[model samples]
Target: MTPPSPATSAPTPTLLWIDASAGIAGDMLLGALVDAGAALDDLQSAVDAVIPGSVRLAAHGVTRAGLRATKVEVEVLVDDPPHRTWTTIRDLLVAADLAEPVRARALAAFARLAEAEGRVHGIPPEDVHFHEVGALDAIADVVGSCAGVEALGVTDAVVSPIALGSGTVTAHHGVLPVPAPAALELSRGWDVLAGGRGELATPTGLALATSLAGACGPLPALRPDRTGIGAGTRDTPGRANVVRVVLGTPTRGTTDAPVVVPADAGPGGTPERAVVLETNVDDLDPRVWPDVLERLLAAGAWDAWLTPIVMKKGRPAHTLHVLCGPEQATALGAVVLAHTSTLGLRVTSVVRDVLDRAWVAVEVDGGTVRVKVGHRAGRVVQATPEFGDVAALAADRGVPVRQVLAQAQAAATAAGVVQGAPWDPVDGGPAPA
Candidate 1:
């Protein structure tokens, strides 16, 4: 596979910020997107590609607590099947004739639901049966929502803290808490709130939200060109029971620290900003710390680490620190909250001056190890071989890791990938040695 490289010509991605402050459901989100201009016919066509004439979708404008909103209702035309297993659902999606992205998104959402259900019921994910989510309407909601998102051309999404609701409700498993166990499981690494009475967020809804969501935070700075409101069943007396969608292009140089930096930055290095999310945990199992860090990095954190500390009453703890792009603050914060015993997170925006860098591949023994070269003012300031590459080469050749590291260092130096060497603008450094 070719190595990763920075994008040089991609267009600025469009942002779809979902406001689930009131709550969210599969149909609620779909309605919001439709109201915001995602064509309903397109959604129906996509759903038909999968279920094929089994489900129908229609939308109408209505008022929820004095606010106008759209409600898209799913009507099943055929006899719905009994509870379906994750394996069955997976096969159906794999054979679906939908767009690649739409199919992929739907599959991901269902996969999350299956995993959550499996964990809650102590069954393997493939063997877990989806009861409520297996219903025809639920299937329509999941598939149509994915298709709606694609129709709008939304490239990225951020979700606000979700409202899980209060009280209890009855379901296929009998009486369950407001935020059903499966929903709660799926919401593990997301910001959530109990915004109202009854079940505001359902498992299917949370599955879709968490699957599509890239981050969780307040709406970033953007010039919204379209807004849509989707109403839930109840038109509660006071508050509007609705989900909101805001579509726009992110505005740079505004609050929430834009990722794009101005070109006039000083010569010392390029100045960019990142957010630091920190939290302290004392009650978590120590054995799980490594997994926590791994999850954070996998979730898009630039870096994650732990610092030991002592809390009140001499209790020992560790403060988890996550450094990430501003856009990733809430998402990474959610990961920390989910994996650790922390009840809150502290977010701080920091400006960093970073040197220009490039990658160089050098032969160590017979293996290639990529070296990261940092430079400033057209001079190489630092050069270091990637440890992952070095370790792999050591394992392959059955040599001591240190020996491989030493040889890689010498190879880099011989290749002029050293401090103070004139930087090569072509691909950031000299060609591989």
Candidate 2:
């Protein structure tokens, strides 16, 4: 009788948790799902759209093993159950016309299960036997969930501790241990809770939740847009046996902008959320530059670089620039002192009108170049050419590095491969690289 933790952090990202102590088979989950209010009809249409031929997913409200729930069953026209292998799943997905990455994720999960089953049974990873029930049920859960995600437009999946109901469950291998082998194998490193009268986390839940979540960890802050609760068959005296699916966006309170300063230390300041630390030095050992950059990176600087320039009176000086989050000011200064000979470093909290960035490979005249495209305020603001790629191609094609860099940029822009910004200052702009 523990009071539910005070409405934890206001939901930020979409998260889901399954409390399966009473017993959560597919049917129970489907029932609770109806109660949780997932758009079952919409999901059905999505499945049909994604998978050819009329597909009907039966989601009817019901109770299981003395618990109220909804039952979901999908009936596909008679055909071979489809060979149940990693590639078998792959080919079915290919023929069904589902999304590529979605198909890949499901296949990877199946491959993991096959691997674990192989290890547990001492068989080849590919040769592990999956019974007809297991294969059909796994496919239904994986593909359906993928379709649901696509319908929900859920980009990320996070999970809470899976409460594993203890006791025996019958599988094709005859009555086996709770969690079964496949489920146990997938549960490694995740928080698992047990203390029920039946199997809580079934293999289907294990494979789906663990594999797609990217990483298993505690629920992150999120904004709940929708809450869908799927039920387990067990009904403890005072608890609801269910899984909760919360969908939402990330709340933005995790970051705080530091006080701003004038760009040139003049009378006023400019708008910018990012900061830069810089200093000029002519009286330092050149041997320390590499170590200095490394320490800056270790200290969490977004970028640290030294630009060689001719100083006043014809002396050669190196300008060190460190770009970082505003909160990084104190730590970066310490790093500067520990690694460099500069006694004073100028700090500026300036707005970095940054653009969303994505990596794209463009076909340059000489060869291929991986260009990073950036966008700001919905317009591409920068396209930074990959330096090493240009250098390598230039050397190979007997062309000047500058020419190679230009060609790469042109190619990236021509193909519309990099959507956002292009690094305008060709020889400028440094990163933590």
Q: How do the residues 353-374 of candidate 1 rate in per-residue lDDT, one tens digit apiece? A: 7777777788778788888888
What candidate 2 gets wrong by more than 4 Å, as runs, is 1-56, 63-69, 75-83, 232-239, 253-433
| Cand. 2 Cα-lDDT | 0.59
lDDT of each: 0.80, 0.59
Task: Give Cα distance to truth, residue 244, candidate 1, Å.
Answer: 0.1
Candidate 2: C-alpha RMSD to true structure equals: 17.7
- lDDT of each residue in 133-163, candidate 2, tens digit only: 4566566666666556545555456566777
Weakest 10 consecutive residues, lDDT, candidate 2?
1-10
User: Taking the candidates one at a time, how many backbone clashes does each contain?
Assistant: 0, 27
Deviation from native of the Cα of residue 117 in model 2, angstroms: 1.6
Error (Å) of candidate 1 at residue 411 is: 38
Badly placed stretches (over 4 Å) of model 1 are 1-9, 132-134, 253-433
lDDT over C-alpha atoms for residue 94 of model 2: 44
